[model samples]
Target: MDTNHNKGDKSFKIPGDWIEQSKQLKEKFSTLTDHDLKFEEGKEKEMLERIGNRLRKNREEVLNIIKEINLS
Candidate 1:
């Protein structure tokens, strides 16, 4: 997995356990469908943007939610 982290940037790695994390996300946000959390290689940015847009949240907020899932 190509995980990158940069300060003040909306760049972060999709966790290796993304499949599990995505499942958690779907549970947290019941409205999210399988298509919403689909992970396409090389399209991580697009996926994140889609998630943020669907949830009406910013990139940072989305990242935080994903991060919280990883920590759990």
Candidate 2:
């Protein structure tokens, strides 16, 4: 998997194809709304934060979930 590390953190950049993953996330977590998964070109962090908040998870957990979806 191609990943970009965040400064001073183990957090990897959200995949460029996050929109597809976001769809899977919504299917997995029905609580997530379209607005919650909305993606912008340079707003990856914001998107992840929004998803994490909705799922009551941390950023790393959110990233892991996305990665898992990609693997499937």
TM-scores, all models, native as reference: 0.80, 0.76
lDDT (0-100) at residue 38 of candidate 2?
A: 87
Q: How high is the lDDT of residue 14 in model 1?
A: 91
- Candidate with top lDDT is 1
Provide C-alpha RMSD values for all models, in order: 5.5, 5.5
> Taking the tens digit of each residue's C-alpha lDDT, what string does model 1 give over 1-72?
876666455556797688888899998998788888898888888888889989999888988899899898
lDDT of 2 by residue, 13-70 (tens): 6665777887888899999999888887677778888989999999889888888999
Which parts of model 1 are misplaced by more than 4 Å? Answer: 1-10
- On the 0 to 100 scale, the lDDT of residue 52 in model 1 is 91
